[model samples]
Target: MKEIPEFQTERLFLRGITLEDTSSYQKHFVDYEVVRYLADHVPWPYPENGIEEFLKEYILPNQAMSLWMWGIFLKEKPTEVIGAIELCRKGKPENRGFWLGRKFWGKGLMTEAVAPITDYAFTKLGFEKLIFANAVGNIGSRRVKEKSGAKLIGTEPAKFVDPKFTEHELWELTKEDWSKP
Candidate 1:
């Protein structure tokens, strides 16, 4: 299987998620505000063993199967995970999702972390296109997609952790377009 690649930005480092990251993951992800708009799959109150279970069941197996997932960390303090990002092979109006601690909001960190992964998806992984969607009111996520050069395709009902069904704006970025400039 292809090894998951590590990435770096001016201010952040993107590396494969690991069991050692559980404490930091739990520390930053337990905030309601940090996960409010994430998919329903995220346990609302984030169980005590949520990180452990997730790594053992989902992340490790998927990583072995060559899925792309990353733990987002600050360059100065790489041991602490501030957020997570993943590009899944799942079907439908979206295949990418991410969340950052409330403290990291508006820092443009996500946008920086996204660029290389978007390129890896298209240029390295050979996907024809990438799909992204954000809860209608998630302006921060929407901006990240836009900054990555994704085009707003339309809106669709999406499931979220708090509110089961939310209207999400779907967006798309094609490999062709991404290669243009």
Candidate 2:
């Protein structure tokens, strides 16, 4: 993977996640409201060392190899990790995944954060297109993709940390589509 570039949006900062971010990542992200929307593989009662283990085993090792991850923060509170966005070269039917702190919900933060990443994916990372997915009932996530010009290809059976979510929507955004006004 290319070096994970840091981004500064109008109100947020995006940087590669690191071990130093452990506490803040747990503080903001270890919540049911936030994790429920994620895939079923994530444990509900997230283990004490979950974040650290994840960074050490899954992220740090494969980073810059096949995966890229960025910790999301508000410029006003740059030290706190309020969310994360990830991109993987190999798709499990989708190339991206993300989650934001519940307190930051409905603020258009994710949409703002996604802009630069998507641009980098298409223009800088040589991705012809990006596939995104969200639980069928996740309106906020669904809207994020919709606003980004992703077209809904279809829905498929899936599972999330929250058992109620039984299906997921798959959306696609091509370089051609992203370049449009």
Candidate 3:
């Protein structure tokens, strides 16, 4: 298995997910506020073992292959995964997806977490461009992509845990446009 390297930002650390993170993952991720923004495929009444099942089935197996995921942690609370970010080689319309705990929202933490991952995608993974999407009214997520210089492409019908979100916005960022620091 290709080990996802551990890295850090000014206020956060990023590392691979583990079964041991199940408790913190469930605590932060199972809330309706968080899950509501996700693709409709995520069960609304999250299963009791959702975190464990996801780690084993979706995240762990693909972590070293077609997908890469990182458990986002605060510098102070290094052990708790407050959020997650992922990149996939194949675009199911978009190559990136992410979520931050509601308590930690509006602090630009997700934006901070996205930087190194985007760098890893273009530089390490050799992606020429990346596609991103979010439910149409999800301004927070859209802002992260916009702040990183991604252009708004268009919108398309999409399903989300929040049924009111009937469409999603698409954005694109090419290697030539990525401003790496």
Candidate 4:
């Protein structure tokens, strides 16, 4: 398995997700505001064992499968997780996803964290393209993808833990386009 490296952005630090992060993860993730638009796999009520099971059954076991997950922390408070991001090589339509605590929503923190990971996706992992999809109403997420230079390819029905099914705008970024000045 490829070693996951830590990343530092101007205002945030991105590191591997750890079991110790469970409490922090729960603090931010259990909020309906945060998980409403996320994938359907995210438990609606967010069971107590959610993060633990994710770390053990999914993340830890999938390192060799090219799945990378990160805990986003502010540089000033490096030990606290304010959000999370993941880049996976599993399925189609979308391979990248993230969510920030409601408190940090409009600060462009997610955008900052995205750049290095996107570069790593192409330059380190050798992925030819990266895909992202967000609920049609998730303007913040859409803006992140737009800022990252991902182009709108189409729209499709998507399932979310909160709303179940909704239309999502799909976006794509190619390594060639992302590498350009």
Candidate 4 residue-wise lDDT at 129: 92
Question: On a 0 to 100 scale, what is the lDDT of residue 113 in model 3?
Answer: 91
lDDT tens digits, residue span 1-181, model 1: 2358899888999998988999998998899887888878788778889888988787878882546779999999999999998888773457887888889999888888888888888877778989888889988998887777789999877788769448889988887666322
- Alpha-carbon runs more than 4 Å astray in model 3: none
- Residues 69-140 of candidate 3 have per-residue lDDT tens digits of 999999999999999998999999899999988999999898889989998898899999999999999999
TM-score of each: 0.92, 0.96, 0.97, 0.93
* Best model number under lDDT: 3
Error of 2 at 175 (Å): 0.7
Window of ten residues with lowest summed lDDT in model 1 = 172-181
lDDT of residue 161 for candidate 3: 99
- Which regions in candidate 2 have their CA more than 4 angstroms from the true location? 1-3, 179-181
**Better model by TM-score, 1 or 4?**
4
lDDT of each: 0.83, 0.91, 0.91, 0.84
RMSD of 3: 1.1
Candidate 3 structure, TM-score to reference: 0.97
Worst 10 residues of 3 by lDDT: 172-181
Stretches of candidate 1 exceeding 4 Å from the true structure: 64-66, 179-181
List all candidate RMSDs to the true structure: 2.1, 1.6, 1.1, 1.9
